[model samples]
Target: MKRPAGMSNQALEFIRTASTKASWQEKIILLEFVSGLRMPDIVASEFDLSPVMKNEYTRLLIERDSGKPIDLIIGKKPFLDFEVNIEDGVFIPRPETEELVENTLIRLPKDPQIIVEIGTGTGVISLALARKFKDARIFSTDISSRAVALAKRNAEHLGLSDAINFFEADLIHFSGSEILKGKVNLLISNPPYIPSSRIPHLDDEVRLYDPPLALDGMDDGCSVVRRILDLSIDYLSPDGLVSLEIDGLIEKPLNSYLSQSTLEFKKGVDIRGNLRFLYASLHENSFSIQ
Candidate 1:
């Protein structure tokens, strides 16, 4: 195959060899490695291709062949308009999660004062919220110390450190919960919602590289969702909204569970039209687990 003009010989060779094992999208991973250009920039032809060191090109191919995700290989992933540093064991933010952020934004009250985010893996959701709601005080928690530290670093990088408080705690169990209780305007999460039994069936990119702590949702996949709902009863203001990213397959079971709560619930689909997000607001009636 003739090398596309402006493409370096090394890049062409990398694509040819890497294409053997990689899908067309995976083949695009070479642009990230060689030019540091994201898919959008590449699609627009806005970047100049440069020669990659032979040794580095060979090393990247080895990593790619080993089934390492390109985001991990590059040490960062794009979220919305910014990039967040990531490493192995941290859940990489997904396009669906970006949709989750947008969905939450439309539902938020103007001048939302307090926001709480659970399972802030790379802090992308909280960071995006902080950027949008400059006056809102946001608190985010992650069970992994590494995740918390990385998120703090991302916040510092984006000059949003003051807007968000990063905590190394399980969902909503951090030190600031006392102050946030009954005052939060929005409580949002993209918690683990995949059934424990399905973990092994996930793609190797997910099952092997992503942390189980961020994926496994215990039995029937609503364990964390249920916990978040139960805990929201204490933290959410009477008008506070709860937004979550959930498995599309669990809508029936989740609605059954939500039926027992005092929250008024609505569900939305992703761009693919799968039920993927849940939005809820507390009612005047008291919450109960039943």
Candidate 2:
């Protein structure tokens, strides 16, 4: 949707200037990009200057002038056609992750597929995929119970509870296999792939506000990716597909690794030209279970 008119550019500029020395203004912009929340809300509830009784507008101006990440202040983010609940416990969903759903939808077969999404997060990916593939039975899992509940809430709020099954599992480590093993026609994942060392270098909003588990990927940063690939082989149907979202920087290494696998895999780029998706097929030409 187009941004609402009458949002004072002057106010935004003031906030920008206020946070000049810090990265808070950039954080606000990023939040706006991700959540679609306006400057009014940012200044109103985020910094809590609107109802302060005295010097309200002045305080709002001062806070904007002081600089603070809007997500830190506003406390939520929107993603993939839905307003996903966000907290320090969860990683805010990104635009590139949406590409994983878009590309997977493009390659889906005519019949139903038992789709499983690993690391469901705020359940944005699963919800987006479920919305697109309405007939597909979606089972979404995450390690965090809070995230699981949040996902469930989002699904029910979107009237998608009947279409999805929510589970709390540690990246396929839980008893999820009882219902998920060898049953998933398609396995989709957006695993944590960021390197441990790089975590400190990320933007303040991400480093400070997003969950660490959602970003850290061990020494070489492929720990979660490798685990997903290794564990998924048995879960996939004979000709079922596995789609993954990975860091573009590791595309070369991942591609080289996938080349040696029995499964055939291909990469897809997102809107920003990032190699955001990895599509793998167990066998060519058929999506049916064998």
Candidate 3:
């Protein structure tokens, strides 16, 4: 069998200079991942794949040099505790977003709770929560149909189909009316918060590949978040908690919004010490959805 390409001195140099701004460990990881050639394969391909003609390896090098993100090139990203499949259509889950899932789980009632996640991009957050809280029934929604399918596939792949239900619709639109209505003990979302004007400034991988709706918020980057806050009063159980991921820069605006709401709320920072999540709950168990 013809051997696949090895990491050439040229390729190594190419990667080194290409990713020089990135740390040494990062560059090594990027090279290994982007080429899709394993260590042994890389060692063997040195002879056959060197001075490459037009092929996948050549394309990977070119793209890497051009600043295409390795995850997008490799078509997946490791998020939370799972390797999530990714494509150009969905939002790439970030480590900071994990804060929403972790904090929400910490605050959930120990007894069985109906937990619903809005805008479940890759099902990363919801799947992790379901695995962590085996006693909980988890339901998730996405405004993008492609995202919904992706989330369902992710759930099924992770053997979580029995524990997680998937739906397609805008945030709270489908959530407020159905088996999910007024019974949810917790609500979680990582809605898009990149203000429209600023979305264009995002990295090419994000601006060019990820779904715009998953990144671009309206003018203030709060359209979807504001809507979610509005519906939490009607959709969440009295004792239910709502946890949302937000841009740290908007802490003051978000705090002001929660101030006027009947629910009491708190914000928490991520591992990077950035304000990343909002936790809100009604004042009492008697606070029914009226």
Between candidates 1 and 2, name the one with more favorable TM-score. 1
Tens digits of per-residue lDDT, candidate 2, 208-270, equal 767888888877777888778777778877767888888876766676677777776677778
Better of 1 and 3 by lDDT: 1
Clashing pairs in 3: 6-42, 6-45
Model 2: ten consecutive residues of lowest lDDT: 46-55
Clashing pairs for model 2 are 18-65, 19-67
Candidate 3 or 2, higher lDDT? 3
Q: Best candidate, lDDT-wise?
A: 1
Arrange candidates, best TM-score first.
1, 3, 2
lDDT, model 1, position 49 = 41
TM-score of each: 0.88, 0.76, 0.81
Residue 270, candidate 1: Cα error in Å is 0.7
Could you give candidate 1's per-residue lDDT for residues 1-290 as a string of tens digits? Answer: 77555565655665677545656566666556665667665545534444554456557767777888888987889999999999988999999999999878877655578999999999999999999989988999999998999999999999999999999999888775787788888899999999988999999889999999999998889999999988888888877888899977677679789888877777888999998988877763322211
- By summed lDDT, which 10 consecutive residues of candidate 3 come out lowest? 47-56
Tens-place lDDT per residue, model 3, 180-205, is: 66788888899988888888798876
Q: List per-prediction Cα lDDT, in the order shown.
A: 0.83, 0.70, 0.74
TM-score of decoy 1: 0.88
What is the C-alpha local distance difference test score of candidate 1? Answer: 0.83
Say which candidate scores most in TM-score.
1
